[model samples]
Target: MTNETKIPNTRWWRILPATVLVYIVANIDRANISFAMAGGMMEDLGLDAVAIGMAIGIFFWGYLLLQVPGGHLAERKSAKHFIAAMIVIWGGCATICGFISTSFEFNVVRFILGIAEGGIFPAILVIISHWFPPAERARANSIFLLSFPLSAIISGPISGWLIATWGWREMFIIEGVASIALIFLWMPLIADRPSKAKWLSAEERNWIESELAAEAAAKKAAAATNKSATKTSYRELVFDINLWKMVAVYFLICCAFYVLSFWLPTIIKDILKADIGMVGWLSALPNIAAALGIVFFGRMADKSQNRRKYCIIPYVCVGLCIIASVFTASYSGWLSFAFLCLCGFFWLSGHPVLWTIVAETFQPEVAGGARGAINALGNLSGFFAPMLLGYMIQNYSRDAGMYIFAVLVFLAAVIVWSMPKNAETKAAVEKTREHVAATTNAHA
Candidate 1:
């Protein structure tokens, strides 16, 4: 009867908070530019609407290239040092981004920031997959993801105030400094694997190790039962239709999310004709809605037995609300913003369920890389989404982009509704086999 056995839930508190903190900073760095753009960065740099979108979208381009490689590095090397080093690097990038005068400098910094920050999520997911058993994994993931919206909620007002008073440079440098300081906390606290968790008693260690092993065996058994969907390799992952389907679903979601995030302040300002401070506070409203949605949908995905049903609902809501907001914008500004808030809610909620499904789809052997790939490919939406919206807003109306987002997310919902489940992991293997056959037949 060790303390570890007595305190199974305690590690969760330690892990979740630290992980949450890292992502909060990551997202703030990722998203604070939106506030800056609205503040005075645009005017100072002489950026037009299209250029603004390009600056925002460019981060994902470098981030996209590193997905599989970064995951591999984290999996192969030391996650603690690896992740810490990247944070410090990106923190530096974030700080430097504040001083840049031209569009080129801004885009260069953004692309570098993407490269630095891109690996953290997948590596964290890989870490989470190791620490918790299957039963607890989804919830842990949800909590991790919840950090994004939570960070967004806080960043809006804080960034707005910082920009309004101290200026955009101050906001970036301050946030970047905060991220750099977090490295000390991370290096000391995080253990690469359960065996390395010095805080856990030997008995507790055994329990965790055994539990994870049993889960793996169970997954393997399920794979056996499903007739060998468990076989995976880098080759299979690239060619697998199912994985590609997941990527497509996430790309659509990313489009809506990045568009909403990068443009929300502008939209709010346009509606209310507000100052930077007011825009900051007003921008937080949708984030507040999104934060609640993340929590609600996290629990919803965990408790519900059917994955597709749970996943599809939020996306449908995203699509419908986005479209409705477009119509609502005609009559009432407040009403339109409210609908957009609802869209944020559903848009943010979709990730927990989507990743949960992705977890079930890929074997643990490849889950880390798989997540990186999904994130990489999916996040390409971040690049394209801003550009798309920039074009629409530049050419048409501010609300014009929402129509495309609505259609895309609706189609994503349909894809999720249509996808086959893991069938306990064997279905995943079967998918590969089927995909290979279909490809061969097509070429033949």
Candidate 2:
């Protein structure tokens, strides 16, 4: 604003694609298990629904081990190096999944894979925080999160075809090797922050640095007025009521999300009475809707001050759609599929807003650890959701587990609604708005 040229958004072009690609590969490795289950891994390994669920759920246990430490390392050390090492290690574990003969062996490899992949999410979030300022963060998060649905869209048919043509073993080998190869691409493209990026012009770097510094100052100012504004340590953060509220919300959200992610292939196959290949193609539809919803709702949240409303609305809609899909499945497969697409749209779209809330709530110093703790605790539901759903599907009707998913998502919305307003985030947003306005005036 002080006679400097307007900073270009060079970070988005340089940073987003690399992050998106890394997540896509990571998700493909994570989610391809669903395809493996549907495409005969269960029968080959002599696993029932319960046994497979346990194997799938066990991954989350290992996932919890590294999250906090990974986040701390990324914040204190280097995200680029941390993520690169994880990619190589996880890729090796994923490849080992194809070679396992016993259920114990499968579970072991999956646990190792989970440990390898645990830190990647929080590390990437830290990286995003370093480069994008508060005002642009929601949209940046949404774009990065596109990898979730986009991975499903790509992996669905591709995984199905791979299994059909070769075998589930080969599918695992192929995807794992592909994830390993991506390390080369990720290493060269990513920088820890704008300051470290050689490709960034001095003006852009200065703009980013100044904007981030102003937000940090705003947070410190807010902390002076609000007793609970800043948390200094993990022990203090654990006892914080606001942190627990967010963890509860995220835990419920993950319950619904993982249920759909892990079970959708089998659900689709059941609905249409179709083969695995057709199920793969059909599974892509819901994710296409999810992709569109993320872009639209992410922009909408960025434009509005009441981002909480955006989060609440989508969660409520997701709950309703899940119930509707269950009811419609008996009458019409296509109708049921339509409702599932709606569920995907709403559930996935709300994620960026939720993360934006977390990013805004914490200071830069504790942001990494706070995010890691929330993510680790929230993801514990990933373990229980699948196992519970599998037990329900095995014992009762398929729709039985879905009813619980609907209720869980509804509860998530209620938690979001009840959470107290975040004073620190509000102050930061106000400061960001003032900074933007001043910059505009300076340009004029």
Candidate 3:
């Protein structure tokens, strides 16, 4: 029997669901601020739009602190332990948001919250790399990333109802507490790698280890011949042009993404002239569309193994939809909402595929640090985008901010389409294709 046949696909059942749940709680904690702003936190705190924006944006500043260290620790020490500790820290900070009365207090808590949550993303990516081979990586990434939109889907209406019935403070406390409670499940279920996982059968564990070891050896061999691959040090990685290109691409994508995330509820409320509860439900529609699109496009990218095509296509679509939504907003609210859903569909779908490209470009030895650097730099947009949009909305018009996002997203597509394919990336892609083919033939 083939080794593939001997191994059960237990990683999917064991790992994906646990990680999804952890991230769901994490995202909800981070995003619940939007509902609070809409619900009356601004009035309660006596804060203006700019102040609120600062409060939201400050989180990213703190978020920048731990990303590289977190990823490195996850890779070198243990993803399972690092992530568990972060969950506790973020949960405590999230709960603290409930008791703050002033904008300054809110901003301080949010910053700490950002720092607490920042490392979780790259750490999770590191965990995913440990568990899944290249053949399944994109799909695995998409499934795990489902936490993004799924959190919005689940949180939107629920948070709305919680805020509507009990107020935003209660909503924050409840969700924060729930996030802390998740640590129990996380600790027991997660293992840093397959060999450490007690739940996997001996045969399954052996297969996973062998496949990963082979892939690692191939990468080592490729690095022997490639100068770019030889430069794995932090200083060397920071100076790498290809790494910065990815950073720029991710930064532009994030500029558009954070605007969509932080302002979508307000935009929906303005269009519908609806109550907070109705706005919550309406906001969820775009994310529902995003969830479906992520699943569809993730599978397509995996099947085709053309990461650049998938990433660029979705980016183009996202840009067009954002621009279209702006023009349509003045004519018809429902039409504008439809365009927003389209924007969400494309915006969120590209992320998993883009990360797949990152995984393929960097060897596992440096993957954690590389991912940390990219995510940290790219997520700086989380600070800039919301603050810029809020200023634009206050001084100029909402459409102006959206136009900027569209332009930035379009630029991201150009970068992805134009990025140079290096020897290491080419070799990785060829290896992945061969691995996928072998696995397929084995199953057949």
Candidate 4:
């Protein structure tokens, strides 16, 4: 491995805390609601399963609307300021939840909170694409995203304890305060571009910048053979069949992951018939497994540089586990839990793999826009998945919801299987040249 690809660099040390720790705090803000639901937010608001689902999912609606704008904005200008502003807004919205008594009030703030958070991940992707070369990016994306499971590992029990002792309202208000405080850490530590990261040694900075420049040059060279590529607008990311294929797969992945994220505690509690606090700790096991998977799969992807295989494996695992969990839960609750833990383990791998494919496909200049487009579209699953599960649980059975999840994962696997490989991406670009030639001749 080259020096630049090594993980012992100053950049990982600097960027990991900004992305991972702050995201840990952000996850706390978003996820505390699950604890709150368990803590009696549902009873207080008189919300049924469907209402809970919509409340959980509506945030994505607002989140979805601004993703393109938020992503493109970060690409055009400064992610540092854009992310800072979003944290503050989401923090405020989380705080508002503590005071909200009505369902309307609750959903409204959650929706606004979604709008605030919509850009942050896309902006971070922009930042990563700039600072880390592709060789290190899967590792970077893995370690950075490892924070999601880490958040669950840490937040699950803490939220449970808080809800059990104090109440759900206090949990929201306190976590919101924590979210606001993290922005202070974010602003000082995060630099939008490598040149601004003065903490790095001069040599380190030069290496990162030069490596990224070389990758950009390579992309341009690959595109130059495609006559239409010269005229290819960044807007073309929207229409790229390959890009959309990735997005659809990610959507299914989100559906499975979020079901566990938003609903696992509730499901586990039904199986165990135990204390909420115990459920908190029990629910944490899957997240711990997921955290390990994120790092392990990310590093493996970086080392192997076999992006599509890694992506496909996780969805297949998730689908199998979804089917297995139905049988396991019928016999043993612990067996069902073990299946979910495995599901979480493989489920977390797809994300880092997906982002690595994107980083390898698009340049940093438009990388945020591409990430935003994919996430905006992909993340719509976050909205529908929860709502559908909620509907299924209320009308049919939780097993019925699992069936839907399995179906989604099956479709996701199909899409990932069809996605073009790296060499094929080049071929796809070359095909655009042929299309341009044929059109030119016809018009002439």
Worst 10 residues of 3 by lDDT: 420-429
Evaluated at residue 241, the lDDT of candidate 1 is: 73
**Candidate 2 lDDT trough over 10 residues, lowest sum:** 1-10
Best by lDDT: 2
Best by TM-score: 2
Better of 1 and 4 by TM-score: 4
- Return the candidate ranking by TM-score, descending: 2, 3, 4, 1
- lDDT tens digits, residues 93-124, model 2? 98988899999999999999999999999999
- lDDT pick, better of 1 and 2: 2
- RMSD to true structure for each model, in Å: 7.6, 2.3, 2.9, 6.6
Candidate 2 residue runs with Cα over 4 Å from true position: 2-6, 224-226, 422-424, 427-429, 432-444
lDDT of 1 by residue, 1-444 (tens): 212336466558767788888999999999998999888899999999899889998999978876877777767666677789889999999999888989999999999999999888888877777787554566778788878888988998899989888999999999988889999888777887878888876655665665566555555657655422474678767777778888899999888888888888888887767888988888877877877887887777666535677679998999899888888776888998888887877777878777777766666767778889989999999889998888988799767778888899999999898788644553333444345446556876
Q: Which regions of candidate 1 fall more than 4 Å away from where they truly are?
A: 1-7, 224-228, 422-444
RMSD, model 2, all Cα superposed? 2.3
How many clashes (backbone N, Cα, C below 3 Å) per candidate? 1, 0, 0, 0
How well is each residue in 325-349 modelled by candidate 4, as lDDT tens digits? 7778889988888888888898788
Per-candidate TM-score against the hidden true structure: 0.91, 0.95, 0.94, 0.92
* lDDT minimum window of 10 residues, candidate 4: 224-233
